[model samples]
Target chain A: MPYVKIELTREGVTREQKQILIKGITDLITETLNKDPHLTHIAIQEIDLDNWGYAGEQVSVLREKGITADKK
Target chain B: MPYVKIELTREGVTREQKQILIKGITDLITETLNKDPHLTHIAIQEIDLDNWGYAGEQVSVLREKGITADKK
Candidate 1:
């Protein structure tokens, strides 16, 4: 069984969107990875925009510069 | 970018194994998910065999019955 987890920082994600994400991920795992849906465990943790950073730059900083960090 | 994360419960995993897991996951995200390795963020949290449960059964219980949960 493959255990999948996600941590993301994004704005304007609703609960419905989260469900879609979960479904999409599950489908991807099953189709692309050839894993069993029931045996695959997945979890997603939402991080505030202010909480994520990369290359010494915060997500907000990147966004202000027109760089979008798309959630998968 | 798609954020990939993993949580696993297993025994006899060494530090080298953990590194391999990370590299494998990063490659999978880049190749299978078609995401940039730099943009794609991933994390793996190791859970003790006693800490994970499924279908009202612990990992140890399943393993004792000859059911192996393979790490992806």
Candidate 2:
């Protein structure tokens, strides 16, 4: 069994995005690792900014300081 | 660095339960794998039943047929 997990900050991701991610990942694993599509499980986790920490600071606090993942 | 991801069906898990799970898992990893707690990451994902599949059927459909994880 191949299992993949994706964690990202809660950013209003649509259901279609999640479905595409799952399908894409499943296909990648099947092609790259020769895994069965039916046995591949992908779970996407959306963590609230307040609950996610980076660089010793909460992501929510970082966002207040003009720091965000989308910023270049 | 140690990372753990737990996936469960959306069943109204309380915050306290998640906290306990995180703490317990952190302790287990530290004790067993000698990993630093600060570098450990734990994510709990609660997925909608329709998004999770089992036995070639969606979990929601299985639940409708009275097949559930907690029934055992």
Candidate 3:
């Protein structure tokens, strides 16, 4: 069984958005790995800005510095 | 930054159990990967028996057949 998890900032997520993501990711992984959807487990996770960091700084700090999604 | 996610069958789980798991996993990953707890993100997702499957059948179906946690 292939367990898939997606991580993103928990900013704005609607039930509809999550539903679409679940379906899309399931389709993508099943297609790529040739695995059955029944056996594929997908989990979506939302991360708080302060709890996640990159470039030796929290995501919140990076945002304060006007950093875009990409690394500076 | 490392993101860890744990997936288990949603049969019997308590808030205390999840709390313990999150801390233990966070510590393990931080120590093994040399990452900061502030930078490490952990998410736990529980799956329903019907939504999870194995051995070419739904987990619920397998349970009906008296299959153990391990494969037949």
Candidate 4:
């Protein structure tokens, strides 16, 4: 069994998106590792900007400065 | 900052329990990793028995068979 966790800023996330992410991650893991789909566990977590940081600066602060950009 | 994810079976979990878990994980990361509490991220996820497996058997099946047990 494999456990995976995906964490991102909580600006916008929908139930449908979460569903897709869970399925895609599961499929990727199963395909790559040859593990059973039912045995793969994927959890997606949205972190508030204030709780996420990069380079010793919180994401919220970087957002205010317009220096933190997400690619994709 | 470090991100920590805790995954476990979802049988009985309370909101209060989750709070304790979050705090404990964050504190541990902050202390051990020397990361700031405000920048540390901790997400706790509970997986359904049907989704988690061990030894090629789903946790639900093991539960039914009384072969899977959690310590503490």
* DockQ top scorer: 1
The native-contact fractions of the candidates, in order shown, are 0.30, 0.02, 0.07, 0.04
How far residue B17's Cα lies from its native spot in candidate 2, in Å, is 15
Q: How much is B47 displaced in model 1, in angstroms?
A: 5.8
Reference-based TM-score, model 1: 0.55
lDDT, candidates in the order shown: 0.65, 0.78, 0.72, 0.73
Instruction: Order candidates by TM-score, high to low.
Output: 2, 1, 4, 3
Our model 4 lands, by Cα RMSD against the true structure, at 9.1
Model 2, B8-65: lDDT tens digits are 8887899999999999999999999999899999999788865664433456666889
lDDT of 3 by residue, A1-72 (tens): 776666877666654566566667777767888877777655556789999888789988888888868665
Who is ahead in lDDT, 1 or 2?
2
A1-72, model 1: which lDDT tens digit per residue? 568876666566568766765676666545544445777767767777677887788888888898875424
The alpha-carbon lDDT assigned to residue A44 of candidate 1 equals: 67
Residue-by-residue lDDT tens digits, candidate 4, A5-44:
6777887776556666666777777788899876766655
Chain A, candidate 2, TM-score of 0.90
- Cand. 3 TM to true fold: 0.50
- TM-scores, all models, native as reference: 0.55, 0.57, 0.50, 0.52
Off by over 4 Å in 1: A14-16, A30-36, A70-72, B9-38, B43-58, B66-72
Residue A9 of model 4, lDDT score: 86
Best by TM-score: 2
